[model samples]
Target: GRGFYSPSDATKWVAYESEPAQLLTIGLGVGLFAGGLGVMLGAPGVFLAFGITAASLVFLQFGVAVPVSHHIALPAAIAAAASGSVIWGGLVGVACAFVGEFMARTFLCHGDTHIDPPAAAITVMTTVVNAAAAFGFFALAKLPA
Candidate 1:
């Protein structure tokens, strides 16, 4: 017997999963994973320094089903970490500041100003970094404990 299978059927697919718990758990796991990657790459401080600050912005502005952005800050962070120098953090921070400012002016400040360029940039950059970090860290973590 053929029945009327509506689009709403798809929406009801995950009815058993709690949305808030799912979102929070995923967010927390991602935060910890990203932070851990920063730490493992020889930059212990980056977990708090850049991880919290940059990753938050990226997650909020461009995470999930969004247009995506410039948050590819991991490489810079990795370099900074490898250097074992606070000076490197300062340098990368300054560079990111300039990039954020330029993005704000060139994109966010136009017309209705609906989008936040700095946040978008940071978010997208971090997203790419996180993806790379996840894969890289996964490979490293799988080295048989």
Candidate 2:
């Protein structure tokens, strides 16, 4: 009950009205679409890395902001909790993949040192994506349905 809203709290009225399932489904659809776009754009097979990075971001957010929609049914609440991450992660994955591809061609082409520029690029991009997702999620979650 640590994250649960009190039964008498007025804030929970919004949680009951929010459409969490729709939000989650939208995120999933967007993510898959973005993946397809990445493939078409000739990203350098970074889907696995992208997924891992996204998952990490989602996990971190879950830890930091553990919101509980106690008014909603269990399944719906879970979906709502999950949708934020899925949507954000997918967007980040696609954006990072595109940027990583560009970095690979631009700065990573130099084979002078042992540093893998592509990996570094992905790492930096992931950090930015995570930060963006965190802020975006916080803002979006606070908005009324």
Candidate 3:
């Protein structure tokens, strides 16, 4: 009599568990570091930066299932995060200036757009530049450092 026999072995499953935990820890640590740097340089809020990086990494993990799609998706997430941060920061700066100008004019009658626009523009430029530079530095730096 020939019957299908299944081997009951739990040893392989136990070994597999440890490696994934270590890998996940390493990935999270790296993501946190990268995201923290982005926030420090005014790229974006810490949560946004970490979310973007984590999403990108998660997309990339499916490289085998859809190789080309994963390749395109990861970079797209990074770029979108960087550009969005720059634009959002810039808009916030401009809005703040407008509010400040309105308050000043109402209270002190001395504020004007003649100076506010330029100041806002500079703020936007500075925020964008700093964000880009921080991103570049991280890309070129040694990993896990």
Candidate 4:
């Protein structure tokens, strides 16, 4: 029920939809703050922070009446949910944590100013995942009934 979209109303899942141009832009805005935190926190601290965020998202999805498909900050978790497996969502969430930290250390950490690792990571992962979804890569993953 709280999933991306029910089979009957598939239009609700607009996580990567480029038409409105809101979710991606919102991610960038949120990323500015998240990246600042990453720069201030350093190392696994930022990674752990994102992990908790992702976990909270999962909780919100399962525990509450929320849909995370439009959340670009946690693209991996979104992808996992699109794949129709909450377990996979948890695993992907952790892996995505590593990517956020890695992106921070590689791109943002070395820079003199805050480049925003979470933003960069989200952009990269979201593009790839959305592209895959566009190509029907996730078409095989049955939506729950």
Cα RMSD to the true fold for all candidates? 15.9, 20.1, 22.7, 18.6
In model 3, state the lDDT of residue 47: 45
Quality of model 1 by C-alpha lDDT: 0.41
Model 2, range 28-141, lDDT digits (tens) per residue? Answer: 443444434333332332344234334444654555432221111111112223333333335443444344434433443333444443365446654554454456653564
What is the lDDT of every predicted structure here? 0.41, 0.37, 0.34, 0.46
Assess candidate 2 and give its lDDT: 0.37
As for TM-score, the candidate ahead, 3 or 4, is 4
State in Å the error of residue 128, model 3: 32
Show model 1 residue runs off by greater than 4 Å: 1-44, 51-77, 123-145
Ranking by lDDT: 4, 1, 2, 3
The sequence of per-residue lDDT tens digits that candidate 3 reaches over residues 1-145 is 3212211233221122123343244323433343344434433543454454446546546652211111111222232345433323323333333333333233333333334322343344445435654778424432331
Each prediction's TM-score versus the true structure: 0.37, 0.35, 0.22, 0.43
For candidate 4, lDDT tens digit of each residue in 44-77?
4345435655565576656564323223335644
Maximum-TM-score candidate: 4
| Candidate 1 vs candidate 4, TM-score winner | 4
Could you say which candidate leads in lDDT?
Answer: 4
- Residues 6-93, candidate 1, lDDT per residue (tens digit)? 2132332122221335423433333334334444565555544455555455655543432121232343454344443333333334
TM-score of 3: 0.22
